[model samples]
Target chain A: MKNKIIAFFLGLLILSFAACKKDVAQDQYEVNPVKLYPSIGAKNKNKTQEQYVSILYTNLFQRALSGNQLVEIIDCLESIGDKELGREVLISNFMNDPQVVLPSDSVMRANPDVFTEQTYERFFVRKPSEAEKTWFRNFIEANPQLSAEMIYFAFALSNEYLYY
Target chain B: MNRRKFIRNAGIAGAGAFAVPYILPSGRLFAATGRQLAGHVVYVLFAGGVRQQESILQRYLDDSQGFPWAGNIMYNMFNGPSPENKIVYGTNQGNGVEGGTPIPQILSQTLETQGTVFREVQAQSAGHFGGLNNLLQGSQVTTQGLKQKPINPTIFEYLRRHGGFPASKVWFVGNGIGNGLPLLNYSNHPNYGSQYGANFFAPSITFGNLGFEHLSNAKVYHPENELDPMYQMKYFLDQSFANVGKGGDSLGNTEDEKQDIKSFMRSTYDRVTQNAIPFPTITENNDALNIGFACEIMRWFKPAITVVNLSSVDGCHADFTGYLRALHRADHAVGHLWNYIQTQIPEMAGDTVLIASPECGRNLNHNPIKDVNDWYAYDHSDNNASRVFTVMAGPGVPQNLSIGNEANPVGFTSDNVPTIGEILGVKDEIMGAGFLQPESVSLFDRI
Candidate 1:
């Protein structure tokens, strides 16, 4: 009877402990995952907000924003922040404000490592994967003329940053 | 000892619910393998229940008031006599005498002369949303609850998956975004979901003064000297993201496609700023604004398929006269938009097909309320509310064709989707997917 009690308690303890600790290794996952990320709300409730989603979208194709709303909407705000606010204060600042800048080519040339680390931490929330670091470094070296904002923007607006 | 430390660390990391985002999936999982018949389709979810008597039957008051005061108030789509003695729908600003506008009537032609219409169509649901669901999804999902993702896939999904059309090619230009109208672009079906969805936006919200200031002719950010501003912008974006409630994911465009869309968006914004396209002049009515934008979309993208909702006429619950005015204006808007597509949009003139239907009809019995015009107000909850009509015109549609009069009722509103599928050349694959309501059939086939 004593042995049985110990076994049962042991099982209970194991279950409790297992539930508490998520592996840190799993936390980082893959920087460039082999499989496509499930879209926001597809597999589960995983999607970045407009800023990250929009930024990720823009960096992929460096330029202006689109006039249309192509992405998903919430149950409450069927369209978005009151359209006037979305248009006037919010979206305008993201796309129009010239002061709202990306990294210039010269700055990126001067400090690629710092820019890279900041990107991984801010966007991916982790250290750069060797593959990602190597590829980006080569990209910068080859296109030394690319702006600093381009690299930062890439990470910030990357689909990776859009972790659901 | 370290196990406790690991647990603590994991808790901290998981606390914010932050984690590395999985890469977004891309590639045409299902190429629009469906056949292509019509180059473009413009569908109008003519919302708010239109009573058979007031609309198709043109029975102005015989049934309601026991008087034969009937005339064709909706003259644009149907081939019937004009509401000559009754012209209350137009603007009275001319002489301040009420009920008149100089806006020339569309003399080009009526829909009956060029298309097929079902006068005694059967609408599955009397409610606006479900009726719209039936129209878009081609189903009669009686259990579909209000303000939720549709269980079945929408026509938008079929167009993308079977037709192999890109997201850029499909659009849902909505009226002011309310009543969950914006949510109809895609559905929650696992197989056919948001990835194959339409781009929806309320033009009034996105194209007014605010839009002019921000989106139209906007400059790209420099990003170099703008770090602080970027931070501020990021903060705003983060807040917007944070405010978003609940979740249901949709498919996203590829990086290149997204950029392509962005460029197109910029060009469209620029065009709006420059007033390059002819935006119809709408003074009093709200539905007219939506129609005008529909014309703008046709001119801009020439989208393979587009759906717009007209809801201003749903005002019949109280204001009978007002409902008539709005209904009349709705017809005028459709007429103007259709005429623009034919006479102005050279590319889509002959190739495009148009479909229009009310969600359902109103109740036969009158409500207690009476309008200022002394006409009785009617609500929609009776068996008669299921009675509605369908109008379709384009290349493949039989001209001067009228099917199923009131006595010999012969069609369902759900058939519109399959009819659209047939017209667009994807009926077989869409039907093969097997989500459409069993009753759904191509009106063209029926004809």
Candidate 2:
């Protein structure tokens, strides 16, 4: 029993000495230099990084963050998107899941304006004004690259998603 | 002489009809004392009802369970050896055959040898959320409810507002989001709401499956992909916030600070993957994981203030043996954390101050159910649940000082707020704020 106790004390002594290698100037505070953490993007990305990351964590990752761990948040989002194939299945399932369901072509032909209310109500959380609607319809025509899935993904990653 | 008295005398108004308001209860806060004794403070809400006898007093099972054991399982904080009996709480790797080697007491000097202790502290509430509110907000509000914002300002707000510290400098790192723990980083008080709130995040969630799924690549989207999700997710988040009653949670950092945190988190990931940062040997326990990540935050940002919560021991409500094991492990996690702070983190080595106390304590009597080992579990609903202790350790604290007792209690659970405020040079500001209990005196003042 005494030998076991001695071994424990001996171990502690070794651990303690191991950490004391760096001799320090006793009263001075040693802080890491400025820009110690590296940010990768240009000013625009950096400016909106908090809002973007906030939306992703809140909506997709489904949690609240204090906003300190941005790298991990982005890393988390990309990995989800990397599984876009698996998530394509999820997206389609979610489309069928009450919230984002769209009318069939024949059904939509009979009630073309039905989707306008649904789109504004579901996407913006509010109905769009007539001027706003006209601008959006023109904008969609002018930008052929904008797809419905891309639009959903865009809203999921937007600054507007996080702003009060 | 007074207007009210004159009105009563003139029979123009009934004397009891006029409402008298107290100064302290009025939500308006006062200025800070500005005694800033330390650069940083790590307040460990060492929660989930730890009893004094089982903890600081080191009365293992002799008192609570009627066993022959009577020694300290928590050798790092208090001075003593663990009890002599079935010590199953220590890590056991051998399929319950061989116990993991007990972590050697990490601190050469026990917290008691290096700091002051309040042997008896009165936790105002036996319930989890209420006790937590009292501990962080520094006032016992019996009317406070759950799933809503705290009624009074937290120490986080007091420190941030009075000390001119940014949101990143104040952090509340919760172990898990269980028990509605995430909502506590800010309060509902209009004067000092989310803007003065602490930057709070659950590390377990961030570093676990969530991190793996979404953040691994962090691929930036094209302009077209970006604009589409904006409106849709807004509606989702708006409803979510409205449900929680904090309709808007501003990230609360300047653009530079936000960028700094982003870069730091990025740098941290690179260093971590490269093995530049020392990851402590982890255990299966959630408390240990929390301590690990908390140490990471302190090392990376060295936030002026950091708060951690340990609640695994809450298992005591059903399984006493599990509770005992969790308590023992909680001590072990704390020991590793302090050692890391003292030895590994050069920035916080000598500059940091640490304070810890349970949110509340379990009842003195045992519950009806028994574990496989036949040890009975305990509940915290009894008034005896208010019995708890507080520990403070750092250079600024008086070494080896002991205060309070069951017979003549000296402090309330709320006292920790003003006490830490005093240590960090914000005592006057915190007390002057007037939201805390007027009687919650600083430990420095008591000394």
Candidate 3:
């Protein structure tokens, strides 16, 4: 009788374990998505040198938290309202799950040293090759309307560039 | 014989009634509703540690670069200095304790006349959180036994409660440094504590107990008892203030103590809560420029109390790629915001108060990595962070006044709450072993 009772108790414990595992797996599939959109006039349309530079300037001015720039950028694009797509298209970008690990603060504490092309590629936006960043920097500078200082500031402020 | 009789008849009630009329509980003078502004506050939480060697102080001492930004803005504000400009160029004494250089010129020439400045002349605690807590909560507490939560209610609460101010009346915004909500002190409120709705961020707002109306209505100030970072804080504060009565909580203490409790609860609770305001959009630019944009936008809302945390200066301390650009932009933003405030809110132009201070000092030592004063560790523990420069000016304030004595910039504790309270027309209420014990009278008194 004692042996039969012990075996019955062990079976009950196994059933409880199975129930807990199922509960844990129930919530794992949930995904929270962040929105992204094309640049205001970039709806398959090429932008002017001035217009592109302005976009770059806005991006540079608003570094890490670039989403907030949407309101102002949209306001400026009012002249092109007829050409505009849905307003929400501006912020419709696919993002890694918010939980994705990024570089630690200790690694990027020194703002200049940490913001290299390789660092950007590893953590933030897809890493543009150093050559590409340099090229973009130069392009921004040569446009007399914009200066090297302005291009450098844009990169510094870009959310794609600012955060890991 | 007649004089002796008169003296004998002089009762305690007669003498007491003759004391200060301000002490008496006359008819409640509730604030006018139209006079009320559903505005936001842009407090430049200038951290601790500013020496006369840098910025404006340097300008006064013939070191032109000391206050480059202030110099540029002053030049722009006024076509040129008139005879009224009492710009005194001088240096702070050699002692390190006496901040680097003293510039009475800027104070007199620029701040004093603007009537937008609010200077806190009486000094108090000099440590980082010590000075900040005093400034933010309007009460000074010691560094050793600091509570995890605010003991004395904050200004955000009081203004919201008593004034029937909206939740969006006050805001504590930053340029996406991830510091989260600036003041989580309201977490102690029964309806709003740190755990229930501690932070004013997206995640916290989405899950918290705060009403959905606040979430839906970003434009209108929704008065509710929920934990939307924007709404609940204002509601909690406003309600606390409206709840105040004269006869309650005498606490069997002296008349002064009774007054202190009454004032502290009424003012601190109302100001902090009533002004739960909107967060700024972190648009493209340096933190300074972002702060400037928010400050300008906030002028439209006209928050009664605003805390504009300029994060870019911290960028300057790190000497990032565009540090100087960021700093210059920040300077420009301050200038623009000041111009807008003066032009748009003519009522506040003279009556409103403007205060500029730093959060903490940077390492004077040039080295970035090995520099002893990096974020991980630095001089603040000692007195290195003790010395900083603060400027204040506004209506009813004295012009070109220096808090430090003539021998030095006036030396007082970092507990400058009394001065702030005076400017806002609230009495200095918090009192205790650590809180801002009103040492000198109003900061307005120095004006």
Candidate 4:
């Protein structure tokens, strides 16, 4: 009789424990969807004349351009109708300046990968993809006569450089 | 091989030939609908407020300053005699009087004798910018603001889009980049914008001291070894960006055209340094300098349409004496430009059409501002400002014909756009576009 009473008590205790158990919800922290731009082309806005000159001067000289110099450059650009041609001439003029900083051809030839990465970073302000890097590497390797200045010129005059 | 087969094939081929239109270089399916009156046109926006009393009227000081002097200062453009006394609209000759010696005529025959002149044409606007817009857009947008791009498609856009003229083929040589002159090269219209815009050059700023300091020192890369690779890389980059859409506006000059323009710029710089520009004999103002560059452009490009803007006479608001001198020099500049086209550019000698018209006329009465000569200055903002003139000379234009008079006005300032359209074989398209002013019609039609 005692054994039967103890079993009944134990059954009740188990029932109580089972009834007290709570359901655990799946862990799913909600977040809003994010739009991402995966390539260098994410930069879509065109740089104004002032912005272009100022940034270009900074890139070449590794320093800021003076206000007066910036205005003069903008004026020179305004004089020409074709903005690309104007920028081309202005860049060439800057290339001719002794103060312009550029990596030596030997340094560029030693590691085109590094040179291209830095160029992309400097002008486009983006990291190049593997394909882009490989293409530039092969181009630099194949063309023995190509100089660092030419590479910079190409980057500076590229359509990508015109935009942000 | 058989007669029936041959006949069928020939008929089919003929039908195909007739049906399939030839594509022009400008990507047009066919040539302009209307007959091309001239191969080239040189339209001069005789801008800046010009007083009809001082210009077409041949009334010098008599009409303005109460002095008993009356004559034509613009002898090159009009058929009239110079003033007998109080001659103060010419180069100074150190005779203790400013503008004592009149500038000699550059044109052997006056433009009035060579072409048709609309003596009392109605200008759409009294303001300078508005008047300029009327001349360029062929319509007057009442809400057009200053320092803004044209509200409608310009003649440059019309000629380029309809006439299929390349960007390089159409040119706008501005006197300076002030007063929205540069903006007039193209319009902000969605359908016809920079793609069909004229290639502009404000030469005073381009080849001036500022340009010399900045643009003169460009490095000339070898076309094959340097420029080719650079272009290849740039094209690759552009291709990558093309997926994202166009990043900036383009004037639609091809690579070859860009190279040609660059070459021209280099040559121009050399010419500027050597003082070899074909300047007018009395190149004492910015207008004359502008004409010199326009001549250079004509000599080099032989563009299909070239519009030169002259605005030195705008000084009339502050200096009447300066206004007279500038007007006189402007006449000389126009004469020099015409002479240069005839004598210097053999390709455009007989085929080119030359048209000149003032934007607006100055006020009838003078302002309080007076010059050292006690001459009163005039501002444009009255009914008198609506009175202007148009003169055109070229093939298909009736020679020595004069239309309209002070008592009976007979044309609109906006007529020049259609007039140019008629000359360039795009009159039907321009009229069909319906952007013109209500009264605007070809000057030829008026004639």
Candidate 5:
């Protein structure tokens, strides 16, 4: 009787081990990867106020910047400071002011590493005119990135903004 | 790992989730591939700076003599007979162009037969390039310093990649100005050269007509090198199964490598042949070029997106003597193309989504003759120029939607992507920097 009891306990242990193994195996399979990136809501909660402002400015400029929004952009730039040079390069390129002029030809020469041959030409030909020069300068002086974004935003607002 | 071993391990481990298809399922899979619902896109760029007044709307509701001839025509066509003689009367308040610029008769008939969908697509830029970029890219992005190519990919690229279409199947036909390197050519997919594809023969050879024979000749002579690099890539991906027989791995294996090699071989051949052709000629005449391309597309390769860019509209802005004629001709081309799509590819007729909008709204401030150098140079009228008219009609779209006073009616411009995406049952991913997705008000919703 004792021998029978020992056999039964041993059988139970084996079964339990098999069951655990099966469970672990089953857990391994997955379908349609759970998204790698977290949702915007979750990500936003962790960002600092400075980060938030940066995102906002980046987002706005990335669209298009118009002459009208120069003042607001200037304010944003003053707040962001000088550490951001990549952004500054973009701003300086756009300003084309007498103090910090980046001519189209020079810009073409500078952009070999960044812009493709075709893209560089298309952009160079359509430079911002003399009238838009001042607003561009003031903003570049205030902000870090040339905010090439203004053109896009300006275009969008120009088309979307209600005139009446 | 070998696919069989991988599968076995996966099954044994119950890692079925990892085996799930990696593609973000574009719901259009069940769609018919061949001639079934095989459609094309017709872009109607009503150039010649359309004025909100005299074109579509009347200047004053009270003044009887205020209505212009164009306004009277629009009222008669769209609004029909009315007691007040105002076509839209009370309905079209605040929607610019009070008198109503009646769509040319040809387009109207085509719309009626083939089914139509229309929207007042919004744009961000008022300038030609800016507006063109917005429409072509379906959104706006900073074109300033970085020169990282335009952020908004054209519909052509989106359709080719996400829409399960071949690049060769898309056609870009230029009107009046013939064809030049399209300013809107920054797509992430293959771009057809003006000299090749459907319009193989030049004007000198074809006698101002499309040389249909040349299409066959071109295909036969260059059958091995028909597709652009992107199409070659896709075809390679499709035939990736062929590599499995050579005792190679499946996932990241020799088969995939072979496929890449095949694509490269095909691409190199195409690049050489494309450059070999004489610089493609630009023709001012549409005649057979427009109609013939339409028919061939319907009969042979049913393209997903076909852009018929009418340059005469821009010509009008230049005060060219025949601007009106060009406008009329563009109207006719649009009409003819619609007829062919409906009659020949009847399935496409219903399923197709046709969008007719101007590249940019013409300046309301200047007349073509008055502003010679800046004739068309009405600095972008903020959103006013962006508020150009768009008419859409096709399968799975609504007929008439009263976009009544939705504060910020997201009509027109790049918002078109999300709207188109909703119709196509895919995620609208072709967003530009700061391109907030337009509120997806699909034609399906109203229809």
Candidate 6:
């Protein structure tokens, strides 16, 4: 009887050992991507004349415009009926000013990816998608004569710039 | 292929080419139906507020100031002798008198003899803005407000939307931007809005000191290399944004037209510096300057229609002597404009129609205000303000004919729009729109 009890206890111990075997060595990697805007659809409101002039002056000069100068600029814009042509002329006039700040062409060409990303953020207030970034980088690399001033001009005159 | 089969195919192709309806740029499947009278039309909203006593009536000071001087000061537009005694409505030759030397007439023949004149016409509005609206919109909506666009389509829209005229072919030149002069280029009507608006220029602000300081230094971008790439980038950005909404309304001027306009602005700036604008002999006032710019615009664009607004004579509310001087100068300006078209512009010579009318008339009675000459001033806003006149001259207008004497008024100021439409071969389209004043009709029909 003693021998039978010992054997039965031994079988119970073997069953417990088989049932408690270690869990499989599975690994997990937490994925949390930084959130970004999907598209430009969120910006819907149009900027007023004052807002446009003020923001444009600040963007180019890194300073705020005075009230009297703002009025004069508005007058210049109002004198023209075609708002697009008016903006073109006004931007060219600003570019002609000696104080207009722009980076050198060599700097832009050396690190196109960084320059383009910064430009997109400065003007559009958003990061460019991979496709947009790649397209711009290719465009800049192809055209050696293109200047930062011209790119800035294009951005300032863009239809997207007219809205907030 | 056999010769007989080739001939049959050629005939079929020719027939199809003629029978099939082609669409115009304005999206119309057919061309205008009315017969065009002239290739161009120049409508002048003659000085702000002219008095019948001083203008068409030729009463001069006899009717306004109780003086014995009774003669026409607008000899270029009317046929009458100048006042021999008190010749104060001319340039001051540094004499003790303020105005002593009258400007010589510009036209060999007066407009009254050259074409038909409506001696007395009814003005729909006593106010300046409303009267101007009547002349352009051909409708006097009681709800029309100041400083707002017209409620109905203007002649510019009618010609562009129905007549298929391009934006560069229509223009409105204002003396200044004040008094809502810029708003007259387009209307708020949903059917015909900004896409068909005229290209407007308030030259006093556009080409004056302000323009010189701002617009004279535009950079000339290369068409193939620079501008092409820039425009491509802009288009991409626009497409991205357009997925949501449009940015702003455009006047529908093609890129080529916009470039041409920029070139014109550059040349005008150079001309101003050289004192080469075609100004009248007595170019002392804003009216003369405005007309000079109008002449330049016509010379450049050869537009289908050009409307020039002159308002210097509005000073008459406080100065009668100044009013007379301005009236004489206004006549000189008109004479210069007509003479310029015939002599300077070969394309428009003898083919353009000239129409002129005052927005409203001044009060028959003088106000309490007195000028430096001790003469009483006149203000508008009475029954007399509704009394106005219209003068038409050009190819299809009747010569040496005068209708509607002071006692028998014949036409309304709103008739000018339909008259312009008739001249441009879009009268049927405009009349069918059902937006014009009920009584409005072509002046030719009136004849």
DockQ of each candidate relative to the true complex: 0.06, 0.05, 0.01, 0.42, 0.01, 0.42
Q: What ordering of candidates by TM-score runs from best to worst? A: 4, 6, 1, 2, 5, 3
Candidate 1 CAPRI classification by DockQ: incorrect
Q: How high is the CA lDDT of each candidate model?
A: 0.69, 0.67, 0.36, 0.89, 0.39, 0.89
lDDT tens string, model 3, A1-164? 99999999999899889878744445475435622222211123334323433454344333333443443343322211111111111211101123223344333333323344533333223444455456444443333343222223233223232112
**Candidate 1: stretches off by over 4 Å:** A1-95, A98-108, A129-134, B1-37, B61-68, B84-86, B93-95, B101-103, B217-260, B281-283
lDDT of 5: 0.39
Residue-level error in angstroms, candidate 3, position B201: 8.1
Give one digit per residue, the lDDT tens place, for model 6 in B1-447. 999999999999999999989988865668898889999999999989998889999988999999888998999999989888788998977665769888899999999999999999999988899999999999999999999999999999999998999999999999988888878888999999889999988888889998888788888888778877887777877776778767566888888888899999999999999999999889899999999999999999999999999888889999999999999999999999999999999999999999999999999888999998899999999999999999999999999999999899999999999999999999999999999999999999888
Residues forming the 10-long window of minimal summed lDDT in candidate 1 chain B? B20-29
Worst 10 residues of 5 chain B by lDDT: B244-253
**Cand. 2 TM to true fold:** 0.68
TM-scores for every candidate against the unseen true structure: 0.74, 0.68, 0.43, 0.90, 0.46, 0.89
Ranking by DockQ: 4, 6, 1, 2, 3, 5
**Cα distance off (Å), candidate 6, residue B98:** 1.0
Best by TM-score: 4
Span of 10 residues, lowest total lDDT, candidate 1 chain A: A80-89
- Which candidate model has the greater DockQ, 1 or 5? 1
The docking quality of candidate 1, as DockQ, is: 0.06
Alpha carbon lDDT at B443, candidate 2:
68
Task: Show model 5 residue runs off by greater than 4 Å.
Answer: A1-164, B1-41, B58-121, B144-149, B176-183, B188-292, B320-322, B367-383, B400-410, B428-447
Lowest-sum lDDT 10-residue window in model 6 chain B: B240-249
> For model 1, how does the per-residue alpha-carbon lDDT over B7-104 read when each residue is reduced to its tens digit?
99889889745554332232344444456667999999885788888788876555665566677777888877755554555667675646655345
